[model samples]
Structures are given as structure tokens and as C-alpha cells.
Target: MGKGDKKSKRGKIINGTYGTRRKRKIKRKPSIEEKINVEKKK
Candidate 1:
């Protein structure tokens, strides 16, 4: 069981997603340079 499972112990499921949010970890954090580049293209 994961964090979501523990929270929804009553068998209730979290909406708007296929999985739980609490268990989801950040895969990456883009650098400041990347952010600026995206804006410049627009």
C-alpha cells in the first residue's frame, strides 16, 4: 500500500488522476535558463 492507499483506507479513490498525488514525486526541476528560453520563443 502507498500514501494514497493509506489516505483512502475507506476504499475511496482520488479523482482527476489515474493514481494518487501524494505518492507522485518530482521527476525533474527545469533550470532558470530553460524557463527563459521558452518565454523568448513565444
Candidate 2:
């Protein structure tokens, strides 16, 4: 294949321009008692 064709194929994977979409989620922190116990150990 030509150099331009090779570049286009690489761009598809690296750019992720056609990937699936999913909801973003983050983990919640521990409670107050959990925090206090961790601090006490130190």
C-alpha cells in the first residue's frame, strides 16, 4: 500500500474517531468513620 493509505489506517486506531460511547463513572470515597480509622493507624 501507499504511505498515505498506511497513515490513514494508523489514524483510525490512534484518533478513536469511530469508537463506542459509554457512560463515565467515578468511585465514591469512604465514610467518615473509615477515614478516622485510617488516620488513627498513622
Candidate 3:
């Protein structure tokens, strides 16, 4: 279970792929300042 193992995080990264072993980053919500600007534009 090392870099050659597809089920491991290191293996996922080496393979340039994502799976249960390597989760993709989630999108963050807009910050308070950004939210205010969006409201002003409306």
C-alpha cells in the first residue's frame, strides 16, 4: 500500500486522478465582503 497502490492517496496523486483515496477540494462560500458587493450589484 504505497505509491503504486491505486487505493492510496500517494498513488492517486502519482496517477493524476481523484477517488475515495484522494478527494478533490470543495468550493468555498463567498466571503462577507464579496457577499455585500453582490448584494449591492442587485
How do all models score by TM-score? 0.37, 0.38, 0.59
Highest TM-score scorer: 3
Better of 2 and 3 by TM-score: 3
Q: List the residue pairs that clash in candidate 2.
A: none
In the range 1-42, model 1's lDDT, one tens digit per residue, is 543564453322433233352355569988999999999999
Model 2 Cα displacement at 37 (Å)?
0.7
**Cα lDDT tens digits for candidate 3, 1-42:** 888999999999999999997899999999999999999999
What tens digits encode model 2's per-residue C-alpha lDDT throughout 1-42?
Answer: 333332454454455443233223559899999999999999
Point out the higher-scoring one by lDDT: 2 or 3.
3
Global lDDT scores for all candidate models: 0.56, 0.55, 0.93
| Ranking of candidates on TM-score, top first | 3, 2, 1
Instruction: Give the C-alpha miss distance for residue 8 in model 2, angstroms.
Output: 23
Q: How far is each candidate from the true structure, as Cα RMSD in Å?
A: 6.8, 7.4, 3.9
Badly placed stretches (over 4 Å) of model 2 are 1-21
| Cα lDDT, model 3, residue 36 | 98
Model 3 scores a TM of 0.59
